[model samples]
Target chain A: MNLKTLRDYGRVIFYAAEMALRSNLTDSFVLFGILVQPIIIALLAFWMLGDRGGEYIIFVVIGSGMTGLWTSCLFISGNSITQERWTGTLELMVSTPTPVSVIVIGKILSNVLQSLASMVLSYTLAIVIFGYVPTINQPVLFTISLLLTILSYACFGLLISPVFVLNPDVQRLQNGLEFPVYVLCGFMFPIALLPGWTTPLSYILSPYWAARALHATSSQWNGLGEVALSWAAMVALSLIYLMLSSLLFKRLLRRARLDATLNIQ
Target chain B: MKAIEVRNLRRVFRATIGVVRRKIKEIVAVDDISFEVYDGELFGLLGPNGAGKTTTVKMLTTMLIPTSGEARVLGLDVVRSAEALRSRIGFVFGGERGLYWRLSGYDNLRYFASLYHVDPAVSRKRIPYLLDLVGLSDRGQEKVEGYSRGMKQRLHIARTLLHDPQVLFLDEPTIGLDPVGARELRQVVRNLQAEKKTILLTTHYMFEADALCQRIAVIDKGRIIALDTPEGLKTYVKDLAVIEFEVYGVPSNVLEQLRAQPYVHTVSVENRDQKQALLIHSPRGSQAVPDLLSMMNGIRIGNVIVREPTLEDAYVRLVGGEA
Candidate 1:
């Protein structure tokens, strides 16, 4: 792309991010989802862990953070297009010169930012209120793992958004996927403990690799090489999802225009 | 060069109904319709609900691909070159559905301006200018949710103008606005016309179409049955006069009886404050007034008058009823 085109895309992303932030800031309900839900989940997990919680406080914190991220991905990013469809802005955005994918990326980025904030809040709450702070053996690796995981989740959200737009009833799938994903990905525990048949499924889930890397880095159970491998796996999977989602988005848009279903319920 | 050209454009929608026993139904929204909008001309598409006027606009604006044939705006094909075409055209649909209600009016415009790729410096100046043009200068910073229907409509107009498009499409821009708000919006449209912009407007309001459009196309049932200048369209009813009268609680049978008359072309009824205002058209001119009054048959009738043909009369004659 030329400089002008790049500049235009940058502007589109900037404005979409601004809109996402402004709208979410005003919505008390969305704030509750981002801030309160993870804290509540962390508190309950800590109570359940009890004396065993000291050894796994970091796991609980990261697990709750990932849960918050998943929630934002499932509801915020997934429903972004649905919200726009209801507001009647979806058609307008499609008719514009900018590609809708770019606009959606901007929205995903904004939601990812909120998810990160939620993760941080969950960690702070565990440390300050629950009096549990796990030692970080590889802070740098953990940070990299966290960022890549967030990016991957954002892409995953983008992948699901177009599906929601084409079939609004699929939104119920968001609620259905939440707890199952936590269990399957081993967000609060080790995937090795799960059944052998579920190992393949965990390998395919980016969050499983993310949680593995985070847990290893915090407990020093794995070396730098192992953590690097986890990071590589998450990045590769994220790229695949990003590319696949882009293709899906284009196909969905073509179908919508041909079917004339963009404006209808 | 023509600003817009359409050839045999059509759109068919397939909708599924029923849960247990689903059935698919086909709705042909825009039939084989063709028309040209000249550069710098203000063209109006006049039609009633379900008449396919909005469907036609959607096709032209690249929101819906045509089922067959082709549409071009500013010499660029709408489907193939939609990305480039979109940059040069703007559209505003009637109602307050498109704006981000939580954001300030200015922020809404600013955001759309970016989507259209308007230069930052240009947007900085153009946004304020558009807000003022739509008479929302002082309320630019207020959240859109707090704005009234008319104010939201005006903001919609402002949003469309952010990119300085060559062509503008407005679909029923004054659908539910109060009289004063609708009039203000019409003035904004007039100002855009003064700037030599090619605009394709769709509205059910015949008077608004007559006052604004240089040429009007009356569409019904997915077809353009009549296309002409407002004055030329009015000529269709030149030989007939309209007898308008008010009555208390007129029945449908009475309207059916009036339609059965040989000289009577059409009868339209409007309800106002518990009274029905009837506009009866006939080739007999004022001579049909007495017959119309007599047909009332002891009904409480009040204030009858005869007037010359108007664009509305021509519309009723062409479209066959109220829009």
Candidate 2:
């Protein structure tokens, strides 16, 4: 698209994100996923991996935080379009000049941002409740990795929102789709512990790359080359997801409009 | 030039009914209907529930593609150029459901303005102007959930006008509102029309159609049975008149007998508080009233009155009392 069109989409994204954040402020279920769930996971991981020594504090914090992010992505960002349908605004959103995918990107951005709070909370828990210090070995690299992680997750969420809307049979399995990703991505543990056959699945998931980048930057300095490779994988996977999401969005709109299912809650 | 052109537009829904056997039923919601809405004209599609009014509006607004045939708004094809058409057209499906109930009315307008690509600068001024236009200026900060159905509907009107779209489609804009609220909404509609905006309004409320629409199309069973001006539609029953009589209980066979009588067009019974008001449409008018009493000699009758046929009478006749 042209610059002007891009600017307009950006404006929509900003407002839609703002709206999503505002509406989410009072949602107890969303709060639990973004805040409570991660803290609980962090607490459990802290005790389980405590024997690994104090150096692993940052690892526990990052791992538990990724769980919160994935949970929010799975429940909130994934259900963005479905939520609009429930509010009876799906048809209106579809009728607008702005593409629904842009609005959904805004929502995913908000969800990911909200999910970051879990990381901060886990860090606080390690320092205050557990009496441990968490540090990032490569602060600059970690920040860059965090930003890319957000982008990758946002793109992943983009792919997820349409899939849930277009195929409810897939959506029906949403509850079961969560822990598998957490396990495959090694949110609180390394994937080397899992069977070798599952390593391919972990490699394909952007989350696993994200966890690797964050864990490497936070606790151990995995060499710049390895970190760069993880970053590249996330970037490439994000682009692929973004392209696939656009296709899914087109299919979703056509199916919903043709089947007259846009308003079906 | 026509503001809206629909040529043999149709929409069919394939509904799966059975769980085990999986039977698919095809429902023709809009069946090969065609019409043109002229520039700056207020047109009404009057039909009862499930009469394809909404399906037609949805197609014109680019929310749904017609199963066959074509629809255009402002010279832009709805299907092939839906993206281009969306910015030029606005629509509101009436009810409380379409709004973001959690957001303040002002926030809702601002959000929709962004969706319509209204410049932030323009929206800053336009939002308050629209809130004032819909009489929600004072309540702009209050969440929509607190607003009455009328207030919510007024907000819907304000939301649709955000982009200053050239053509507007309102599907049942005042379906479940108090009489005062309904009147206020009608006034807003008139105001919109006076601004030279082309409007296509769909409602089952015949009186609302009669009071507002410059031209109307009576739709029933997925087809446009009649298209005419308000006065022109009234002429459908101009040759006929309504004969009314109040009775406690009218026998079903007697009502049937009245229908079989000569000069009697249609007989309809309306339940009043403690009595039934029987309305008979006939060309004979009062001339047929005397024969009606003879036929129900033993029935307790109250007051008898004869009146001119109304647009409602025309609708009842056109749709065969389905309204």
Candidate 3:
């Protein structure tokens, strides 16, 4: 990978998000939808887990935050390409020798940056307004969980990049990933609450492990001691999804015999 | 040195169905077309919509892999040395909406300039000159979104040239411009010609192709049916000279008589000032004009005009489609 190319992509992604904010989107709209949306969902978790709901708010906040990042990952990636199509700018991009990674990296970095900023803002509000900071035994261990959670979610975002290539219905497609992830993974509360086989199946999904690991981090349970073990599971899923997504992207790139220009009319 | 070379390129896209079904529907957009664009020639891939012109351009530019066959740009094998090939070339795809709308045209240029690895300081200096070249120097600070279509198109051209590439692939360079804007764009093409830049231009406008291209490949349905200079192709088809007349009070028999003339290929009867008119086609233009005008009698001929067949007529004949 060319470092310059990577830098170039990062610049593009940063510039794109900045451009988007000034013109098409509102500060409140992006903040409220991305940050506040999860908070609202967390309230539902509070209501459901009433009377002993401190742990549940943490679960809901983590889960909702995970979902928030999750939606934008694929959504932004897909929309960046589709928006390129929608706005008619993709052809100009494809014509240059700019590495394809620049596009993916640029898009993800922009979304990641936005999501991270939004994540911080949301957590701030939650701590002040909702009166919650995840309980932790060690700051160092909590930092590791935070890093891993981010890495895992980021990989999740990258893995879904190829769907944009096949056919981009960005908004609708983004909405599709939300409910299933929330229901199957105990993004809020516990997996035991999910009925039938979803409990077992949810364990296999990345977010389920992500929420579980975060919960363990907050509680200092036996599951927390297995934190080192958690890396292996998260890394395993990250590798699989990364490889699969890369292959899918390569295949689609080959098949996508599109000119640098899509027909405008 | 040949700047761009294509040999029997074939690209087939599989139009896939939904998730469960797997079937390959072959869309042979570019099918086995070959040509060598010599260094510094303004070569044109001239065609109408769905004529595979852009596909051929894409294959040469290394955007789409040719399913079979080969291409080399600036002596680099397109498939084998794609990165090197891509880095050396500049490209402008017509009707581009991919620019950052909020960024000033200057900023956009500078961004691409950065991608080319140009030094920031040099980019700052070079940008104004390029913007000036494209007639957007003063407006460079303004956001691209506010610029008119023609201004954006000019800026797009300026952006492609940011890296100082040896070859340029301009697909439909002047697609949707007003007549004056079209003239300005054609002038830009001519100026690029003066600089001796190797360019592959794809255009729907026949006149632009005729005026600017040193050689043109008339493509249709994924293949080049004819390749030559505009005049050379025109010569292949029989040149027709047409003359139109404004006349009045001519009898029905007189219109038939004009068509019966050995030199008059076609005649049309119409009343101009409550009079009769005849449109005649002949083998020769100026030579046939005088002879045809002298024959009209018993009816006043207001005015007579003669002209040679245009490139539009030549293209129609080349495509084997009657106009």
Candidate 4:
């Protein structure tokens, strides 16, 4: 790309982020979902674990926080295009000189920022209320794991974004996928606890490795090599999802143009 | 060079009906049609609802792909060079939904400016100027959700003008606005034309087309049935005179009686503020006015006038029966 095209893309990303932030700030329901849901899940985890909760407090905190992240990705990032469609802005966006992929990426970036903020809020609330602060043996690895987890989830959200455009019964699919993903990705528990057949599914899910890497880095139980492997797997899976989502984005635009569905629906 | 060139453009939509036993239906939203719009001309596409006006505009704006033929804007193919063409053309569909309601009107314009890659320095100056031009300078800081329908429509125009595009396609820009709001928007469109910009406008309002467009195309059923200058089109009804009269409470029988007159070609009734305004078409010119008054049977006639055929009369004559 030339300097001008690159500059235009940068502007697209910048403006998209600004709009998303403005929208999220003004939406009380969304703010409540992002802030309150994680705290409720953290409290539930605290009560359920009881006597053994001390050691697993960090695990539950991170899991519940990741749940908020997952919700943001699903509702905010994945459904953004559908929201645009409903608002009648999707066609206008598509007609712009900037590629749709760049616009979607900008949305993902903004949602990721919001998701990270939610994670931080969840962690702080857990620490303040429950008084359980685990020792992080490798702070650098934990930070790396956190960033990768957010990036991978953003890619996952992008992958599913096109499905909403193609299918009309997307709410059913969206509702059905949420809990299954939480279970399959081992958000609140270990994949070893799940059935044997589900292990392969967990292995391929980016969030499972993300959760694993986070837990290992926090507990310092696994060596640097194992943590690096988990990070590598997450990055590789994220790359694959991003590539697939790009193809899906192109197909979605082509289908929308051919069917004249962008403006109508 | 022609600002826009459409050659045999067409668009077909596949619609599925029923649940268990589904059937596929093919709809020709835009049939094979072609037209050219010259630079610095205010062109109008006059059509009724579901008349393929929006479909044609979508094809030229690169929002929808044509099924069989081609369209070029600013010498670039809409399909092959959409990215470059987009920078040179802008469009606004009538309605208030296309904007981000949560953002302020100024922010909305700024966001669109960024999308079009307008320089920040230029946009800073252009945005306020446009906001002022659209009469929204005072409301620019207000969130769009708080604005009225007219304000939103005005903001839409400002948003489209952010990137100083050479050509603009506006599809029914004033569909649901009040008369005052519609008049304001028409004035803005006229000003845009005065700036030497090429514009393609589509509306069902004949007077609007007559007042603004240098050339108008009357489209119906996905096809252009007539294309000419306003005066040229009006000449089609040169021999016909329209007798328009208002009645406070005219019954349907009186309308039927008027229609039964051999000299009266057609009678159309329009309800205005609880009163009925009847438009009678006849080749007898003002000579038929005396007969129309007598047929009223001493009914409360408020205003009666005999005038030459308007662009609306010409439109009704051409597409009245078929549409």
Candidate 5:
């Protein structure tokens, strides 16, 4: 509400993010999601779509990179609160003056930023292994889209962490929720190929708009109008997610306190 | 001057059972407990396992909303003003689980300091001081995972003091510490109390409570059975004397016979190596010792002695006779 409070929140976020990054460096599962899995997916995409020609190489790179980002968000960021619970720090985090959501935002920021290494790795794979140079058709627009993607993805992650913590049954669906997003977001192929009924589901997901924006900028220029629409969708969805996540966090705390389940690992 | 006030605070947990036909069972963890902790006083909640000590602390710390009634710390209602109160009070739930194992002790302190909104300038100076105070300055840079359990417990104490809160809650702070470590931690608690910090400590260790707390509340089965100073509690058993018998192979039937005696207040047994130490509490005092020894006719009796009742004896009786 005040500047000092905001500054305190900002510091908490940065501190939380820094600690998460430090802690995540040794996690083999996180390393696989951010580093190894994306490269494997990119290699497979290159071999599978080789017949599609050189122009599609950049598309595969972006698609595979986006898959890495979604994977990290789904597994790492989604489990942020649950991880705290496991460590027995959820009670401490909740007891702090700073809001738990701010701390989680910081953790999501680190995971997303760390996952960006997937894009760099994919680009390197194309350059070194395949002897191909992939360039962004619209570098400035691509950069803007990248920033919005991070914001939207962070917000999306915000919604997920609380849900997973509150409903472990939904968390059991985590592995199942991964590849569907890749297909629905058209990470390796166009969603246009999917059944019409699922289009709305894809449209509702911020990652789909992110993939469309990135793919359009990297391989094909779908037009400024289309890119702007994707940006609008991402921005709007991010705001909605932020608002919804606030409600979810409130409910989460209330339910946890009432049920006395915050410390029940 | 009251730092903490609790009025008829109660918490009921609904535990669901069965896979197909679910049944919700209500468990009253804390039932209508009322007390006040004055500022600068060291208060102890003494109880055995499942005595709702942790539940009471959780409610006061605003981690769990009371199922009914009220708890206020630092003049703020725990439920209504939780956010405002969090920074003003500190707590440690006894364990090795709370710290970030991957992070160094210093970094863990830094992280929690920021969470408490401690000024960067203050934290920079205070972090090293706290590390030194907890005797971890030499190892502060090492990952917490490498620290011993006692070291981790000490670090938890330092972590809670990051904001210099006025009110503190410690739930079983020395649960598993060795004697020396537990003694050192108790000294630290004493020093905090000396600095005029109001503290509420919960522990099953009666000696720790006796050594540290100015006043103690003995809770059992979701109720406060006794609230008094160590001396005051000891008085509850003053009418009785404790007689001890060191014997090998004391039969259960003989133990039951001692318990069944009209003059016997309570009988408890402690198993030592190859022997059982029997403590019999009664108003009959040493006069009953001969009869008690006569009852265990077949046992190999070693040493027999009579002593005055202590806070632990009072506690055992108040909690319904299990030490």
Candidate 6:
């Protein structure tokens, strides 16, 4: 990247990091809600399936980490929108010359980092405590899976904030999302374990694809051809989520309670 | 060319009601309005709550697209050239929510500077200069959340000017500040003017508008009812006469007679303990004040104060008064 691009990305990254640090630095217990719970799930998996199950536990841990990051992005729409809707910060930010992209990117970037932190920490803890390790035949897909997982979750979460702008009650809509996501993504168990009727629904959710991809890395997920399909399915899901959310997000913002969204100075 | 040009700008928002199925209702937030601010001059868009001040600012600053009409800031069309316009102006909101509560005043300035594409080294030097200009140099290292309302306001002023934009739009810059803080903030605005930065500001404070605005447009019910220099606009309330007196209980009959007096045109009993305010106006000037004071007997009065029509009086007259 050129100097200008480097500076742009640097500024965006710093803003994201600063937002995370300022908002969450003092709240240590948030780990219980986001991090420790995922770790505990991994431990529970180890307990259930013994050494064979450790791989599933690691998959759950990473998937949950992805969820934390994605959820924050999703959370930003309701959290920041409802907040700016209440406090006037949203209006203030929007009214100024700050690039709309900057604000959107800033929210996503911060969510991504915070989510990444949650993921890395849980994975580290799982490594130290549960002794979870991956089969290393192909590291590229593993890296790509995590990156794509982050991309898919963040973009989907990023799109829904404008709903909160139009309705204060929309923030509560997020709760309905968590249980359905956890169940459908098969994070708690294996996708094969879910009822046959729910299979189509799981296929559409990005996390379902993410959970399966990361799980394949550990469970030996059948063979190369099967693993490639999982990877391809995730890529398709990411694109679909990315495109759909951007369109929905733009439409919602265009129709956003522009007056109500004024965040106070 | 005008630094800012607006042509019949408008924005319509839909309001919704109910729960199971919401009913969408249309609210015309910004009605048709148009005015241009000159280059290197301070203009004020003075208004009360819901007067479309914020919406107008949003349209001018290129945040909300005008549902109709057109606005060009520094010659760039608001909708088409929004990104370019962002670099051309600075905005300082009157509230304390935008700045990072955790970062020091300097850090906040530096952060915004980065967004405006200011070079890092230049920003390092520029931030301290801005902090010093707003008289927050000593407290540059202080976290924004810890700063008093006054200090936070000063930092906001510094933050807005960090990019050194050619134009500045300030929304109620001194909204809740105390007397001293408000005065200092106005002075900073004056300095910005001296440096030739065009300012389009909005405020409810009449005195602030009088002090800083070379020209002001007072918006009410989504319309610009009055637009002129503060002194010129005060003339609109020439019929409003303010006379204060410290009286030891004036009889009702005597007060009623004073109200009927020919030269004593308008009268109002405003609430003040031991002090009665009789707003006396006449087509004839201060000539009526002496005659009215002489007519008052059986009442011990202290200092029948007659004051010239103020901008507050003009604003009240122009905007109208009611509960």
Task: Choose the strongest candidate by TM-score.
Answer: 5
RMSD of 5: 1.2
Off by over 4 Å in 1: A53-55
Better of 4 and 6 by lDDT: 4
User: Going through the candidates in order, what is chain B's TM-score?
Assistant: 0.97, 0.95, 0.79, 0.90, 0.97, 0.83
Quality class of the docking in candidate 4, CAPRI style: high
- DockQ of candidate 6 is 0.40
The runs of at least 3 residues in candidate 6 whose Cα sits more than 4 Å from the true structure, single-residue gaps closed, are: A1-10, A28-30, A49-81, A84-87, A95-102, A116-140, A162-170, A257-265, B9-32, B47-51, B234-241, B246-278, B284-302, B320-323
Q: Rate the local accuracy (lDDT) of all candidates.
A: 0.87, 0.92, 0.70, 0.86, 0.92, 0.71
Winning candidate number (DockQ): 5
**Candidate 5, A183-239: lDDT as tens digits:** 999988999999999999999999999999998987879799989999999999999
**Ten residues in a row with the worst lDDT in model 6 chain A?**
A256-265
TM-score of chain A of each: 0.92, 0.98, 0.78, 0.93, 0.98, 0.78
lDDT over C-alpha atoms for residue A209 of model 1: 83
Worst window of 10 by summed lDDT in candidate 3 chain B: B314-323
Better of 1 and 3 by TM-score: 1
Candidate 2 lDDT over A36-141, as tens digits, reads: 9898889888888876877699998998899999998998999999989988899999999899999999999999999999999999999999888887899999
Lowest-sum lDDT 10-residue window in model 2 chain A? A256-265
Q: How do the candidates rank by lDDT, highest first?
A: 5, 2, 1, 4, 6, 3
Query: Whose TM-score is higher: candidate 4's or candidate 6's?
Result: 4
lDDT by residue (tens digit), candidate 2, B219-311: 998999999998999899999999989999999899889889878888888789999888899999888888889999899999999999899
What are the clash counts of all predictions, listed in order? 0, 0, 8, 0, 0, 12
Residues B139-246 of candidate 5: C-alpha lDDT, one tens digit per residue:
999999999888999999999999999999999999899988888899889989999999999999888899999999999999999999999999999999998889
Off by over 4 Å in 3: A1-32, A46-57, A127-137, A167-174, A219-224, A258-265, B10-32, B114-122, B231-239, B244-281, B284-304, B309-313, B320-323
Better of 2 and 5 by DockQ: 5
Give every collision pair in model 4.
none
lDDT of 6 by residue, A76-112 (tens): 5346556544554455455444444355656665666
**Model 4 Cα shift for residue B214 (angstroms):** 0.7
- Candidate 5's C-alpha runs over 4 A off are none
